[model samples]
Target: MKIAFVGKGGSGKTTLAALFARHMVETGRPVLAIDADINQHLAAALGAPAEEATLPPLGEHLPAIKEYLRGDNPRIASAAEMVKTTPPGRGSRLLRVVEENPVYAACVRPVGGVRLAATGAFTEADLGVACYHSKVGAVELLLNHLVDGPGEYVVVDMTAGADSFASGLFTRFDRTVLVCEPTLRSVGVYRQYASYARDYGVALSVVGNKVEDAADVDFLREHVGADLLTWVSRSAYVRRAERGTVGPLAELEPANRAVLARLAEAVDTTAQDWDRFTRYAHEFHRRNAAAWANERAGTDLTRQIDPDFVLGPSALSAPVAG
Candidate 1:
């Protein structure tokens, strides 16, 4: 399953994403945790030593990545020519998660039991002209080519806020867990995310974070309603883990464990419709290209979606314009 955690900044999505990856590892599942956030702190949250957590961001090494994944393919000459919606073709490469692939070796590193990959941070040199979207594009290309089996898991900690809507990344996941706080601002983010995600048939569940009491839980239930999957109470242990004062988050509070277990069950049982997924992905790419990328880059990226690509149900069948 490919799962992503998204929410407003400081909403604890990164922490929760790391914890869920750890939980899966503890349950004997092979997991790959990708720090797709621009802030890129998931490694520390997962209890890796400061040095170990600082793996090369796969985004910064696109040239090498292209060389590795392209293998014998003579068509894809450079990474710069790659587009977000580019699917694997006859000569293109395919990556198998949790397996010994050259692309995986070039991009991922082991942190405890979970393999970790980061999208590298946006630096001062990037300044005004270099958009963070470039890094996200790299991740999109990687995921576009990745193939995972039933027992393998890929968890991504997405960039904060509605910026994810700027690309087709949201449509790439099997499930998206939104970490929402009790505040109205957080709920507002949920509204924005749901408005866009619902169009894509993407499964969404909200994990109410920092809940203080029944009232807080009630508020989320009332506001998010059926989308509210579970709630995690405020924990001093989580605070300590955040501050690096505690060890790895190997253990969860009983209540927290229960909520996470339920989430795991949902993720495990849900069926992924690949035919529908491919169609949604193409539709989103088309919309994003027309709405933004064409103007921004002065080139039409929508054309990258090959005509031969399989078409399933269109995510745009709904009236929502994401």
Candidate 2:
């Protein structure tokens, strides 16, 4: 299962993502937690020391990543020709959810028993010349080629707000857990996200955070209606964790901990639609190719799509050669 946590800035999406990942890991599920957020605090939230958390930034190694994934695919002439939206073709490399591949070796790190990867932080040089989506594109590329199975999870902490709509990455997940506080601004972000996502068949579950009383719960019900899946009350355990005094998942409030399990259940029941996944991959690749990547690569990038290829566990067993 692939899940994304997104919400307004300071709305605890990252914290919730970390907690959910830890919960999955503790339950013996193979999990990969990715920090696609520009702020990049998931490593710390996942209980990694500041120094050790500084894993290789996926964006900084795009060339090498593209090269490795392309494998011996004849369609892709060179790594330079691959865009973030490039779909995998016959002979292209495909990845299991948790694998011992070069990409994982270079970009993944272990934090408190959970595997973690980060989209390199935006630095001073990226100030005026680059979009953060370029950094997140590395993640998009990986998900495009990844084939995950039941009980295996990829939990991503996405960039805050509706900014994810800027790229096809928004549609890359099986579920989007939107963290909403009991506030007007937070609900506004939810509405904006829902409006955009509704058109694209995105399955969204609203998670209410910082709920203090009945009024807060009522407010979420009033705004989000049936989409509100669960809520977390104000948590002292989470507060301590946020303050750098990290504790084991057992120390978390029972209600909040149950909320995490509920999240896992929700994701587990949501079936993967490989046909839709492959279709969207091609759809967005065509859009990007027409919009900019074509001119940038000096080729019609739509040809990168492998028409007979499908994304799922079966793709691993199928012959990748034409």
**lDDT tens readout by residue for model 1, 1-322:** 8899999999999988988998899888888889998887998888887877787878777777765555443334444555565554434555666667655777788876789998888878877878768887768877776666787888999999988887888888889999999999999999999998887788999999999999999999888999998889998879888888545454567788777788899899877776766776667667767776567656766655544544222321222111
Q: Report clash pairs, candidate 2.
A: none
> Can you write out model 2's per-residue Cα lDDT over 1-322, one digit (the tens) per residue?
9999999999999999999999999999999989999999999998887787687999888899999889888889999999898998778889888778888898898987889999988889999998989789999999999988988999999999999999899989999999999999999999999999998899999999999999999999999999999999999988998888779999999999999999888999998999999999999999999999999888888888889988888778765532
Candidate 1 residue spans exceeding 4 A from truth: 71-80, 248-250, 284-322
Worst 10 residues of 2 by lDDT: 313-322
Q: Number of the top candidate by TM-score?
A: 2
The root-mean-square deviation over C-alpha atoms between each candidate and the true structure, in angstroms, is 6.0, 1.3
Instruction: Quantify how close model 2 is to the true structure by its C-alpha RMSD in Å.
Output: 1.3
* Most lDDT-accurate candidate: 2
State the C-alpha lDDT per candidate: 0.78, 0.92
